[model samples]
Target: MPSTDRRHDIDALRALAFALLILYHVGMYYVAAWPWHLKSAHPASWLQWPMLALNIWRMDLVFLLSGVAFALLARRAPPLRLLGRRAWRLLVPLVFGMWVVVAWQAYAEAVTRGAVAPGPGAFVLRYWAMGPWPEGAFSGSAFGITWNHLWYLPYLFAYTAAMCLLLPLWRHPAGQRLRAACCALRGWWMLLLPALPLAAYGLLLAPRFPATHDLLHDGYLHPLYFTVFAYGFLLGTDAGAWAELMRLRRRALVLALVALAAYMAARSLAPDWSEARQALRALYAWSALAAILGFGHRWLNRPWPWLAWANESVYPWYVLHQTLIVATAFMLAPLHLGPAAEPLLLLAATLLGCWLLTDGLIRRVPWLRPLFGLKFRRPATATPAPVRPAAEPIPR
Candidate 1:
């Protein structure tokens, strides 16, 4: 297949992943252990299982997909040009979202937690002045300003910039050897070997550095995420690797299930052995990632309008969804609605708000579009206003 032939499956998968994130953030409101911005009035222990199932691989899959995105862009633009474009694309949204979209999350959390007096407008003013908020306020109160979910944009931007420095090296013999090594992953090796580094990270660094998502101090994540990202960057352009993934799709799925089962069993059985738990967790995560990659390649390799729409709208939705969930949950929690109703209502409001804001507002507004990571809305060409034939030389 030509490199330019749109990878419809990857597009669909990306959309699905972000959608899952929104749902997962919603889950954070109810999960027993997640240190989300806010919690539901009725936290449920059962939420832990599903959240774990998704949490392990979700962000990793995104990092891999992002590398694929890098591969796609790198094919078209020169390294310097690509770096510039990426900086614009990622950093603008990061800044815009930090000021506009993400701060709301911090504000909402503060209000809900009662650390701040009740005033969105006033809190936004304080946020704009960029003072250190009360220590307990969510979203990096210590830093005085927080990027929250928009942190992904800056991280991606940084990674893209760093990769630019390596672009030239990738053509050298050593880089060629590295690419060869990565491309060689397939079959049983595909099922297991890529996970070793990740398992090692979990067992070793995770104990030392719990995920801060704070970029600067996040030891384990930097190595793990960047490595997977590099893997995606290398493998994304390699037809052999893609074919290998598709060919091993079923086995990957089987392995994924087996790994997940083993992980779950270990959690239940050991529940305290850090080594066993972390190892199984990594196994489960990587196998599941492989399974999704294969499965997406096999099944979702087609497109529809909704997929296109999702392709466009997903970033903004991601930017917007968590806040909506937090804001909505805060309002509804006081209603003392039963668990089922409250969660369902949160989902509905989140979906509706995201859709309305993304499609109805963001897509249509000329200025606001790019802030949410959208392209310029092409101006409708003006019709030739029914050209009247020069008035027959004006008979004048």
Candidate 2:
């Protein structure tokens, strides 16, 4: 059975995951041989190593946490009510984000690429009109619009709806038995069994679909993400599963590190070994996740002064971070600041923007709350009542 006690570790892990995402986007600007909306004048070849390490599993971790969050919320409300609330929370921001928050990113990309004339006013008019643009106008000009970094919102909302539709079966005795069997896995079984499906997906589906991130066409990612999401949901309240994670935390870390080293060596030394590399990548991804969960549960389960604030602020930070990075980079590129100073300035500007906009403007304005994935503040004049715990917001 699910515990009534709060999962502080899960909350902390989610916050940290989003924080890592912010850093990753900043790195994207400097990482060499990768396409980003904007790129630094002097790209660092070495940056790709760390970026690739993170790219393998960061979004997977986010989806897993989303499923864990959904499991918690599902325990508190009826399926229909939960589905309605999720749709409102997810879709509202997605619409608002694509139109308002994400517009700057698209405009910046088009302007940088010289695909469109450099005028914010004209671009906004054309963008909002949803008409075709010249080839190479922006990241998704072929589609007439782009969600950019906010793609996770619609994907998550879809998964939530699917799960809700299957709620009855999930609650059935057969489903419960299957979940229990998964949770009861221990030792090597815990590590190896979960990775088989991921490897299978990598071997079979990855080459065919190739991860467009455009909800409808992403065949490989849908199964991969949904599988991990289901893993999280199944393990959410399983004490035995968590205990096994904690017990294997050290070994998992070592395995993850070794796998990473082997994978990188293979990529550099024997690029033709596609099947072996794929299997190793899957192994490393799962091991890294297991190690992270184990360490987080061991050390982060207690409430800290910052936890409450982070839980509230992470969603807004996520929605705002990528645009800030792209915009800051766009503005800074012409200055000829040295590589070190330029990226540092960009990072500083992005963090300051997220903090200022999220705290000073978004949180303070009641009407602006829902658009950024926050609940409205209670009116000061209302009668006092016990505070109910808010459902966890899905991380972007």
Candidate 3:
């Protein structure tokens, strides 16, 4: 494939990844042992099994896809220009999301925990002012504010800016050589070598720092995410690498499953066996990603009718989904809906809210676009086709 050609597979993978994230957040509500902003009336311990499988690799896949998106965009614009655009697209939504889009989530959590009385008016006033409220008021109450799920935006923006700053080195001969070596890996090297660094991070940093998701304090995640992000940029347009991934899809899937089983077994059999489990976790993470990308390339690389709409709507939906999930759960809590009816209604309501608010309101309003990480509409005008074709559109 040409460097400029649209990678429909990547687009589909990214959309599917975000969709999985939404589902995972919904699962968070009902997972008995895990902590979320809010919980369902009926938390299922069995959820831990499936949630563990997904939790290992889901965000890594998302970050890698983001790196791929960055590589695609970098081809079209100068580093400085790209940096400016990324900052606008990421930061604007982050600020807006923290203050406005995520306000309901924080409020719901506080009310549910008895941290605050239920009053949207008063809560909004206090939240907007960045309250120094009673301890345990919300997730990030210690910092006087919280971004919740919107943490991804700022982290992505930081990574983008860092990559942009490093563009000069990335374009240099040494960088190209490094990129070439990464893309040239084959078979077992491709499968296992990429995971060593992840294992190292898990063993070295995770014990001390943990995943706080507070940006500045996230020692382990910064390295892990940045490394995978760099991996995506290196392999994004490499046809040979993608071909290898597709060829290895089945083997990778098998390996991922085996790794997951081993990791879980180790945890159950010997809870203190940290080193082996971490290695297994890293192995599972990379293998699962490879299988996902490979299968996506083979099957999802198409221009489906709904893809265009999905591509555009995904950002707003991501911003809106968790809030809807939280608020819906809160509203339904009073009625004492059973587990079966409650989660079903929560899922339906969340999806409906995302559709109604995003398509019905946000997309139509010009001013609201940037606040949700969408581009402003350009006036329709005739223009000549350029020598280089536009790249595939990836979710921000």
* TM-score to true structure, per model: 0.94, 0.95, 0.94
Which regions of candidate 3 are displaced past 4 Å?
A: 1-4, 378-396
Report how far off residue 31 is in candidate 2 (Å).
0.5
lDDT of 1 by residue, 137-165 (tens): 87787887788877777778778888888
List per-candidate RMSD values in Å.
4.3, 6.4, 6.2
lDDT of 2 by residue, 277-314 (tens): 99999999999999999898888888868999999999
Instruction: Report the CA-based lDDT of candidate 1 relative to the real structure.
Output: 0.84
Model 3 per-residue lDDT tens digits across residues 1-396: 334388888888888899999899999999997988998889999999999999999999999999999999999999999999999999999999998989999999999999999899999999999997799998998777799999998899999999999989989999889889999999989999999999999999989988989899999999999999998999887889999999999999999999999999999998999999999999999999999988988888878677888888999999999999999998999999888998888888988899999899888888898899889974467989655546856458
Which regions of candidate 2 are displaced past 4 Å?
Answer: 1-4, 379-396
Q: How should the candidates be ordered by TM-score, best one leading?
A: 2, 3, 1
Q: Report lDDT per candidate.
A: 0.84, 0.91, 0.91
In TM-score terms, candidate 1 sits at 0.94
